[model samples]
Target: MSNGNEAGDRLRVGSAPDSWGVWFPEDDQQTPWQRFLDEVSDAGYRWIELGPYGYLPTDPHRLRDELARRELTLSAGTCFTAFHRGDVWEQTWAHVRQVADLTSALGARHVVVIPEMWRDPASGEQLEDRSLGDGSWRALGTGIDRLAKALHEEYGVHLQFHPHADSHVDTQQHVERFLEMTDPELVTLCLDTGHISYCGGDNLELIRKYPDRIGYLHLKQVDPRVLAEVQEQDLPFGPAVRRGVMCEPPQGTPALEPIIEATRGLDADLFAIVEQDLYPCAPDVPLPIAKRTREFLNRCGAGAR
Candidate 1:
C-alpha cells in the first residue's frame, strides 16, 4: 500500500513538465511548444499533463511525436465544460469520448473532469449556490452516474471528478453526497488539495474514507489566510483562481501530514501531480516548490509499497 523506496522511482514526485498544464492567461509570450518541452525536460520531470491551450497537440501522431522528442510521457489531460447544461449532455459526452480516445492513444490512463459552467437553478447563473436543497445533490448524482457509465462502457476511460471552487461539488458535504450517490466502481474521485481545503474540508479524511475510489490527485497548497479572505468576500471561484490563491504543493499553510498518512494505505494507482496555476511570471518559480514537495514525500517514508 505504500510506495516505499523500491517503488519511489516509479511514483516519484515531479512537476507536470509544462507550463501549459498550469494554464496562465497572462504568460502569453508565444513560446514554441518545443521550447516549453525542453524547459520542462531540463527540470528533472519525465511526465507531463496536457492543457487545452493552443500549445497542446490535438493530432494524436503529433502529440506522441512531440512527447517522444522530449523523452517525456503523457501523464494525464484536463477535460472541462462537461455536463454543464442538461441539453448539452450528449454533446459533452461526445467531446469527452474524443478526449478519452486521445488519452488512450497517447498512453495516458486518467482523464480529469472539471465541471465548471454548470448552472445553479436557484441563482440562474454559472456559479454554484451552496444553499441548494437536497434535490440538487440527487440531480448531480444522476448526471455523474450517467457520465460514469459512459466513460467506462463506451471509452474504457476512468472518470475522475474534481470538486472545484465555485462548482456545485466544491464542499465537503457535496463531496460526501456525491460519493453517496455514485457507484464507486465506475466513478472515481480526484482529490484536489487546494480546492478542498479552500472550501473548508478535511481532504485527508475524504481520501481515507474512499481509498479505492481515488484514481488521480492534484497536489496543491494554499495559504489559509488568503483562503479565509476568499470565503469572507463570497468571491466567485474564477477570481480566486486568478488572484493566485491556489499555488504549488508544499507551500503556503496547509499541513500535508494527514494527506501523507491517508495515502499510505491506498491500493489504487494515484498520480500526485504538482499543479500551480502560476504562469507568465517566471518559469523557474515552480522548481523550489517541486523540490520541497519531493522532500516532504521522502520524509513521509510511506513510499515503500
Candidate 2:
C-alpha cells in the first residue's frame, strides 16, 4: 500500500455487495448473504458495506458476529434519499434511522447516502424530472443539511452523500451544486469513480478541486466501448450494467493508479471501497472479479494494510 506514504496514511480499501451482484434486500436472483460474506472474505477483503440494508443481516449483534467470524469490519451502510421532493423529512428519516442505528451500533462511523434516481434503475421508467427547479434545489440542499445534522447528532455517523447515475446529482456540475447547497461540515462526498465516469464526470478534477469534500471512495471504472454504446442508445443504468458498461479495473477508463495517488496526497485516511455494479449476475461471477480487483488495487498502492 505504499506510494511514498506510511501505512496509516494509505486509503483503507474494501468491497461491497454490489460487487457480488446484489441490488435488493431479498431477491431470488441475488447472492445469499452468508455466501456473500464468505466469498467477499475469500476474495481477500476485510471490510464491507451494508448494501440495500437487509441484503445483510439487520440485527446488529448477528451481523457483528458474522463479520467477526470472518475478520471483516463494517465500512458503512447505504441509504437512499429523495430530498428534492420537499417536505419529506419524517419519511426520509424513518428510512435512514434503521440503517443509521445499525451502522452506529456496529461502530461504523459513516452512512453512505445515495440520492434517489430520477428514473427507476431497474425498468428505466421515468419517475421524476431529470432537472431540478430552483425551489426543488433549495429543498434538496436544506433537506440534506437537516438529514446530515440529525444523523450526526443522533447516531454519531457522518453522512457521505453519493451522487448516482440517473439521479439529479450525477454530473460534475450537479455534484458541485450539491456540495455548495449543503453544509460542508455536515455533508461529505462519497466520490464513486464508476458512477462519476458513467455520468461523464472527471474523477481526478473533482478530487483535486474539492479534496476536503472527498470523504470516501468507490473504486470503479467504465468500459469506453460499452459506455459509448449505452450513451448513443440512451440505455438505462440497469441495461448499461448488464451490457458490461462497468468493467473491472485496468480494463476501463480513468486508471485508478492516479486516483489512488491523488487521494494519498489529500493526507487524510479514507476508505477506498471497490464496487462494480453487476446486479443479477451469476453467483459464480463476483468472487473471481473481486480477487482480481483486490490485487489490482494492491498494485495501484491501495491494498489492505
Candidate 3:
C-alpha cells in the first residue's frame, strides 16, 4: 500500500474522503465508507483523512481494524470553526473535541480546521458579512489561539487552519494577516491549493513567505476556465464545486510541481493529501479519477524523490 515512491524526499502523499466525493456523515449521493476505503487503497494511496466526523467509523477499534486490513493510515481529521461569530466557543469546542478524540485515537496528530463560510455552502445564500470587522477579527484570533492550545494540551493534536473559499480568511492578504495574528507554534496552515487558488491566493508565494507555518497540504487544483465562470456568476462554493471548479491535477491552475518542490525545502515531513471536492458526484466517478489524480501527483514528484 505504499505509494512505492522513490525515497529521497519527505513528502507523504495521500488522499482523503473528499476525493471520493464524501462530504457528509450520511449522504445518498456520496460514496459509501467501506467502498471509499477499498477504492482508496486500491487506487494506490496509503494515507487518508477523516472528511466529516461521522463519515467513517467513530468507534476507534472498528475503524482501526478496517484501516489495518486495507494497509492504510489516518493522516488527519477535518473540522469547521466559527470563532468570529461571538458566543460559539462551547459549541465549537464540543464539535472539535469529538473530532479530536477520534483523530487522536486513530494516531493522527493534525486537525484541519476550516473557518465557517460567510455564505451558506449549500444554498449559496449570504449568511454573514464577507468581511469581518475589527472586533470580529480580534475574536477570531483569540478564539483560534485558545482552540489551538486546547487541541494540543488535551488531545495532543496540532491545529492546521484551512483558509477556504467564501470564508473571511480566503484571500492571500487574509491568510498572511492570520499568520501574523496567531502564534505559529500552536497554529499552522493546511495550505489547501484549490481553495487558496479559488480565492485568488498564490500557493508558492505563501510557501516562500511563511515556510515554517506551512504544516500540512491539500493537493488539488482549480480549473481556471470554470473558476472564471464561477466568479462571473458569483457562485457559492457548493455550486462552483458542482460546476467543476476544482479540477483534476495536470488540468488546472497553480501547477503543483513547483508547490511540491517548495514544500520539500521545509524542515518537516508534510502530508500532501489529495482532496478534490466532488460533492454529489456519480457513484462510479471517484475511483478512476482517484487513480488518475494519484498517478498525476506522482508525476509531479509528490513522492519525495
Candidate 4:
C-alpha cells in the first residue's frame, strides 16, 4: 500500500446531486439538470455521481456526451432496496440488473445499495422492526451476495451496501452484524460518514474495523445539534432529512479530517463522493456550497501531495 499522500493522487473528489436538492420527487425546489451540470462544472468538480439513475439522461450515449461536454465523468449511483421485506427477489433483481446495465455503460463500477426503511419517517412509529430476524438476515445477506456477485461477474459493477439511518441496518451493531453475515467477495460497503454519525455510530472505529470491505465512500457531515434533536425526539429519517440534519463540510460535526487521515497510505482508489443532504434551497445556494466543499476537500486531502 502506498502512503496516504501518495494514494491521494489516485483519489478523485466528486460531488453528488444531493447537494442540489435532488433526493426525492417531492422536493419543493429541484434544480434543473442542466443547471446542476453547469454549477458542478463551474465549481471545479471533474467527477460526480449519477444521482438517481433517471435524474440525468437514461440513454448511455447521451449521458456520456453530457458528461464529456462538462469535462465531468460519472461515479456510482444510489440503488434503494428492501429485500428483507418480502419475496421481492425477482422484483429487486430486475431493477438491479437494469441499473447495472446503465451504470456499466457509463463506465461506473459501483452502486450504493441501501435498504429502504420499513416505517414512516415523520410518524411517531419510532422506526420499529428495523432489525431483521435470523431468517430475514440470512435471506437478505444471501440475496445481496447473489445480486452483487451477478453484477460483478456480468456487468463488472460492485454493489456496495450502504447502512443508512432509520433503515433495517442503522447502528454499529446492525452494520457489524450485516458485515458478518454477508459474503465479502460479493457484498461490500459504502460508508456514509454523515449517516454513521446520525445513527450515533463511531465513524473512525468502523473504518479501522472494516477497511477493505469499504468499496465506496459518501463524504457527508452530521450536525451534532440536529442529530441530538433527532435522537432525542426519535425523529424519522424523512423529517430529519427535511430538517437539514446534514450540512456543508465545514459546518458538519465530528469533522471529516480524522476520517480522511485514516485513509492515508492505501493503494485503493478513493472515490470520495460529497453528498450533503440539502432540500428545496434557493437556485443560487448549491453553487457556493459546492465551491466551499471542493475547497475544503482540496485543503484536506482531495489533491495529490
Candidate 3 ranges beyond 4 A from true positions: 1-8
Best by TM-score: 2
Tens-place lDDT digits, model 4, residues 150-229: 88899988888999887878888899999998887788788899888887788888878887787777889988888889
Report residue 71 deviation for candidate 3 (angstroms).
0.7
Candidate 4: RMSD to truth: 2.8
Per-residue error (Å), model 4, residue 232: 1.3
Each candidate's TM vs. the true structure? 0.82, 0.97, 0.96, 0.92
lDDT of 1 by residue, 7-92 (tens): 34335344453333344312353335665667666655667776553456778899899879877787776676534344557777
Q: What value of lDDT does candidate 3 attain over all alpha carbons? A: 0.90
**Order of models, best TM-score first:** 2, 3, 4, 1
Better model by TM-score, 2 or 4? 2
Kindly indicate the candidate among 1 and 2 with the higher TM-score.
2
Number of the candidate with higher TM-score, 1 or 4: 4
Candidate 1, overall lDDT? Answer: 0.65
**Candidate 3's residue-wise lDDT over 178-232, tens digit each?**
9999998999999999998999999999999999999999989999999999999
Error of 4 at 146 (Å): 0.9
